[model samples]
Target chain A: MSLAKRIIPCLDCDNGRVVKGVKFVDIRDAGDPVEISKRYCEQGADEITFLDITASTEDRGTTIHTVEAIASEVFIPLTVGGGIRTLQDIRDMLNAGADKVGINTSAVLNPEFVREAAERFGAQCIVVAIDAKCVSGPGEPKRWEIFTHGGRKPTGLDAIAWAQKMTAYGAGEILLTSMDRDGTKNGFDLDLTRAISDAVAVPVIASGGVGNLQHLVDGIKIGKADAVLAASIFHFGEYTIPQAKAFMREQGIEVR
Target chain B: MTHLAVIDYGMGNLHSVAKALEHVARRADLTFKISVSADPKVLQAADRLVFPGVGAMRDCMGEIRRLGIDEILREQIQHKPVLAICVGMQALMERSEENGGVECIGLFRGEVRRFAAGQHDAKGELLKVPHMGWSEVKQRAHPLWRGIPEGSRFYFVHSYYVQPHDSAEVVGVTDYPAPFCAALARDNIFAVQFHPEKSQDSGLQLLQNFLTWSGHA
Candidate 1:
């Protein structure tokens, strides 16, 4: 059999609790990060991602404890992103049992950080998280730009070129999130996903908009993503990971 | 109590590996005194050994040499049930083409090679390096494969793979466009290119099998 396309359920953690918000607004508590992660593992999630959205510096420590708790019980790959600005942050997350650490704003702010982190920690554990927003509109030449600060600030870097540069800088994987389609319950930006997936030699994980199981399938079959990461569909009890996997398998996609 | 020592050389995280073994041990109602350390005395006194590593080959080899784990591994593999995972498996090979080529432990007469650039799968799609994700493992007859189904999916995250001099030493094979040795078994030593701790059910089953495996083929 061939390599299975991974289905990852992302948990947005705030002050150690799992929370969900539409377009990063009107956020509501879901449950405990550890308990939610264990449930996802039981439901056959290939991996679990925890993005720390805590605003206060003191609350950041809570995310580490949360990760540690889930890592002790959940025997699957766990990735921690958001606020991963320093090597100490990366080490703390890995020490807390995270398999990989995703860097977003830091990589754009200092491209050399990706290289240094990769050399020190190994490329296998360093994932570059890119929040991309399409800048070109209607029938024009399609283009996307990298955005930081939860898609609020624009970096003006071409998404495709940045992805290539990151991989060149030794990023093992690319976590691409489409800011335009995120939280819209629409689907992934197939064009954006395919572009980055084909641009880099490292595995690309398609994140952001995944409204249904069909979206997940398209992320692989059409988007060419090696893994699909979604929050709302699997987080809000709208669908379970097993249902998603079963649907994907029915569509002739290999899944674990 | 059976002492299970996980050799840690400051290479990668060993928390998950130790936790998984403890998880399986509790489930199977088996008592195992699991220790994650680099101490020679602790390793020598252990009944079983697990060598788990991640990162560049040169760094791993450097630490192994600094900690004198190379000598300990050489001695332990003679009789104890030893399990090497991921880069730990690659380290057992004679040399690797990573970090401008690094010499390995040479426990097995083989070389570790990187997945060449511009490789394609059957569908003509370009394959990625670091070959990260879950892939089916074609199993051969081995005690470590016990309880785990043949052709089961195991989690893999590596760019380089092992090539043994003797094909008969291979216990499991997987394809990332091309078939490579996924698991190698010889005498009491069993090495794998995937992470059994993060592999969910099939992986847990493999770890469970490893816990109960006798020092024999």
Candidate 2:
């Protein structure tokens, strides 16, 4: 109730410029992160989330220049994630004007980091992102399984239960992403999103599989998500924020 | 120029609101500029001020105090058009139950309380918490909603709603359990529980009215 219906456009960056494609390929130079962020701000993006897709175990520093550049140019909130392992990384991101920090691989490997981040910088500043794929089965773990390292490795953990643990560890929000639906433009994994939302008390942002405005409405109305996150649809100029909200309004979903 | 100053103090959703205002101004053939900043000088030069929010009311008020915009808002509301949307509107109330308790801008004598619908209304009872969907705003006479139709739907994503001390200030009402105030206005001050920016035509027209009234058209 305290949170608004967020329309977040994620910028997946390798170095500085935005990139696209499944598993990060085609290597399209969308635009400068700062410039693209400014455009999104003008186009009505509630928040900007930058996933340093390249910042992995090998890479040490995040695209600090990109973060600083975009942070200096916009006024809305920004959340920086990817390769965030240590407290120093979180500190650097916050000092760079990031309102929130998202944890993926590290949090999955060491769940205590979530609790540490929450304790140091209020739980509101910490976001735990989960990339999950539905496992095919019945009594033998028929639930969604966690995928880490940008969907390169499967953690073999039930996503529903992991999300509950993350919340318990003091994650302010959950960025629940569907690896199966990601980059497919099919639709959000409503079943996956709802399962996670129903399990947590914090806000849940539904990511992946947003092809049209109806996808967003479905995410909010049926999925019961606090926000919806998409990439290519907003990046390729498929839908403007106003247009999406207008559509949601017609569909009876609370937006903005 | 109809310059709109979108107050910013580490709060999200200002850009989205500004974009909607900018789009409305363009459609209305009005020359308007929307700037997002916490600098006091920008506020001083603004013709209109819009406070947009998407977070806790307590935290928002804390940021407003941190930025020292509370007094500026009071002074500006007396002279120029001020629109408070979503949590922005909630911040205009006397208090809220967001984090146990918090005091807000006393622009209107009201308290924001969470929706208490235990059971689903469709299931022969009140609906659950976190009222999330489009609901009609029973429109009344207000400059901000001049051309918006009666029972026009606007996007609403909030669990708490305002109950104004003076019923006259309630310009729009919508039903959930009982009738609730969806929009409020008194003089230059305007507030809405629903997000007009996200309401499509009805929302666009409302923004157009604000732009036009601010002398942008």
Give the number of the best model, judged by lDDT: 1
User: Which residue window of length 10 is worst by lDDT in model 2 chain A?
Assistant: A20-29
Candidate 1, B66-132: lDDT as tens digits: 9999999999877689999999999999999998999999999999999998998887777889899
Q: On a 0 to 1 DockQ scale, where is model 2?
A: 0.06
lDDT of predicted model 1: 0.89
In the range B84-162, model 2's lDDT, one tens digit per residue, is 8877888888998776888998889989887763534442423534554456678777767777777776666676789
Pairs with steric clashes in candidate 1: none
Q: Candidate 1: list runs displaced more than 4 Å.
A: A55-62
| CAPRI-style class, candidate 1 | medium
- For A44-162, candidate 2 gives per-residue lDDT tens digits of 67778999887764566677678767765654567899889997788777656676789999998899999887655546668899999999776674489999877878989999899
Off by over 4 Å in 2: A1-128, A134-143, A153-157, A165-175, A180-194, A197-256, B10-12, B18-23, B26-45, B116-136, B149-159, B174-180, B197-202, B214-217
